[model samples]
Target: MDRFARIDTLINNARIFISRPSNRDTEGDVTAVLGVNIAGHITQLAAAHDRGGR
Candidate 1:
């Protein structure tokens, strides 16, 4: 789907996520969550911008 593609693009594109592997995540839970949140913001902004700032 386009949404999945957008996510891939977001992850692959220039981005800065505060995700860090931790014990709970067996890696970085906080970092992962932060990155996801940031990505969501980015995606929403992109969508809004594309809609003529609507």
Candidate 2:
């Protein structure tokens, strides 16, 4: 924001994939994956929109 003064485009290419058997997956593990895959994207999108970018 300081250097560019504004945002033109936002690219969200960050993600995490955890492969495990359902029986081995814990609540915390699922929460973490959701937080990164879903919440993370929403947060980025909101930030980009606030910065007047696509």
Give the number of the best model, judged by TM-score. 2
Deviation of model 2 at 53, angstroms: 12
Provide the TM-score for each candidate, comma-separated.
Answer: 0.40, 0.47
Q: Tell me the number of clashing residue pairs for each predicted model.
A: 9, 0
Residue 48 in candidate 2, Cα distance off native in Å:
9.7
Alpha-carbon RMSD to native, per candidate? 9.7, 4.7
Clashing pairs in 1: 18-31, 19-31, 19-32, 20-28, 20-31, 21-27, 21-28, 22-27, 22-28
Clash tally for model 2: 0
Considering summed lDDT, which 10 consecutive residues are worst modelled in model 1?
Answer: 5-14
Write down the lDDT that model 1 would get.
0.54
For residue 40, model 2's alpha carbon misses the true position, in angstroms, by 3.7
